[model samples]
Target: MLYKLNLEHILFLDIETVPQKQHFTELDEDVQALWEQKTQYQRKDEFTPEEFYDRAGIWAEFGKIVCISVGYFAPKGDQRNFRVTSFYGEEIKILKDFKQLLADHFSQAKHLLCAHNGKEFDFPYIARRMVINGINLPYKLDLFGKKPWEVPHLDTMELWKFGDYKHFTSLKLLALVLGIPSPKEDMDGSMVKDVFYIENDLDRIVTYCELDVVTTAQVFLKMRNEELLADDEIKKV
Candidate 1:
């Protein structure tokens, strides 16, 4: 059962990213050439303008991390309640704070870092940015050389597969299907970078990250047979 484990051992997290814009132009010749060569063919067809920008290292210019939010389920009375928190700041500061928080509160718990589609985007991005900032990673999150099935992670997207893993759905759509209200107020994932970079509205990015985290927590709750809160019960972060 999904709820068989203690609540204290589950940590739900999500991150928002905007590719670096400035740094890519400054990539030394060899690196720049390699990047171009790697993306040359693929960029012509399969990539969206936004994806192209990210693959081109535009997010690196924004310092890699735009915002990161985390939620945890802890015992409360006969039921478990959830707590959520997020940080929006310079990439290094936010990543450092994230590291400290994990070390202080979750260093020893046999916790599973849960997210939707995190294995593909959030996990590697966090690990890369952490290394670039010289921060070591926690053991459960060390993704190097591990097969997908070997990782101690619980991606809602993967779980939704029921082993067929077909017909992947968006987080918003999945949450809606599960009767969880959409957490995003007026923005979408495609607009995250634009909102953060063009509008300079860091709060929106943080909010988006928080939304994903909470929605992900709700997914876990549903999977575990716990009673889900109504739309009115969701408090804005």
Candidate 2:
């Protein structure tokens, strides 16, 4: 499937998210009860809602996007390289800037959005966050009545599934198996919340997010049987 993709038309991306509040106690009493109900079946008889609050960022309702890093291919004569950029700071601002970028540069019907596990995670998370922030959905993310075949989106992890529902792969694992550089050099998703809220290091998260975006693109290229980009080929703008 990747054989036919025009690298120029796809916007490769990854996002970082965190719970809206620093801790479960910060949420009001009513919402706390709701979180309990939300996680009861998953939590079972183990941890309480407060004990599991750190994982709230994985759910769109209780979380907000902290960063969204995107990459695209640039042609250099006979070669193609990737350039990355990020939208971050406040969640609302990040969503606004990212939305404007899509509206301005990649709004055409042929433009595609790609990410690892994006169909289940990044894409829906972004759309839900935007709606919660009262922001209008961008054309690419506003699924509406569009048929599955008509949606301009790609998922590398989904492709790797190969119709087997029992299999699952992480982006880092895919990078390792595909011989692409692992983007989890410094911090993984588990550390993102601490790095953002405690350390107050937005740059670290942005850099990490961009690396994942690049790694994801590289994984896609490898699957397409194309040469991976050299370090010198990656230009961040």
Candidate 3:
């Protein structure tokens, strides 16, 4: 099925997020209490709200997307090339930019979005953030009355699950297991918050996010029994 899908129509993407503020203390008392309650089960009794605050980026309410990198395959002479681009810095501005990109180019019915664990994480997170930022939801991201089959989202993690929901796979582990290069060579998600806030290196985070998008495309190709892109074939544009 994936083999028949047009690579050009599939927009592969990944996002990087950080806690809305530089520190947990920056949040108001009400929001702080909410954050603590949200993670209570996971944190148990060992980690306090402040201690687990580094992970606030995973929650849409407590975080803001700092980067949304997208890639798609296109004809480059006689061969296909994958080009990557990113929107970063100033949360609302970047979110609006990304929304405009989708509206300007990828909004057709034939277009689809592909990401690893996107159905559970990336897709919803983006839609929720878009709403929070006052951006209209594009048809592809807005799942409101669309039938289950009508939602054109491709999740690599869900595809790999094959109906066995008992296990979950990280993109890095799946990439290594499937022979794709690890995109985490420089930094992982755990480092993204610090990279954005303390190190003040949004470019590094964007690069990391772009690499993940490329890796996701490669993983999807692998699932379809297709070839991965060569280093020469990947362009950051």
Best by lDDT, which number? 2
lDDT of 3 at 18: 91
Span of 10 residues, lowest total lDDT, candidate 2: 176-185
User: What order do you get sorting by lDDT, best first?
Assistant: 2, 3, 1
For all candidates in order, the CA lDDT equals: 0.73, 0.92, 0.91
Q: Please, what are the lDDT tens digits per residue for candidate 1 over residues 13-103? A: 9988776653455556666566656666778777644446544423332337878899876545755566778977888888888888877
Q: Please, what are the lDDT tens digits per residue for candidate 2 over residues 165-193? A: 77889999889988886644699999998
For candidate 1, the per-residue lDDT at 201 reads 91
Mark the 10 consecutive residues where model 3 has the least summed lDDT.
Answer: 180-189
Poorest 10 consecutive residues of model 1 by lDDT? 54-63
Clashing pairs in 3: none
Candidate 2 residue pairs in clash (backbone atoms < 3 Å)? none
- What lDDT is obtained when candidate 3 is compared to the true structure? 0.91
Candidate 2 residues lying further than 4 Å off, grouped into runs, are none
Root-mean-square deviation per candidate: 3.4, 1.0, 1.1
Q: How many collisions between residues are there in candidate 2?
A: 0
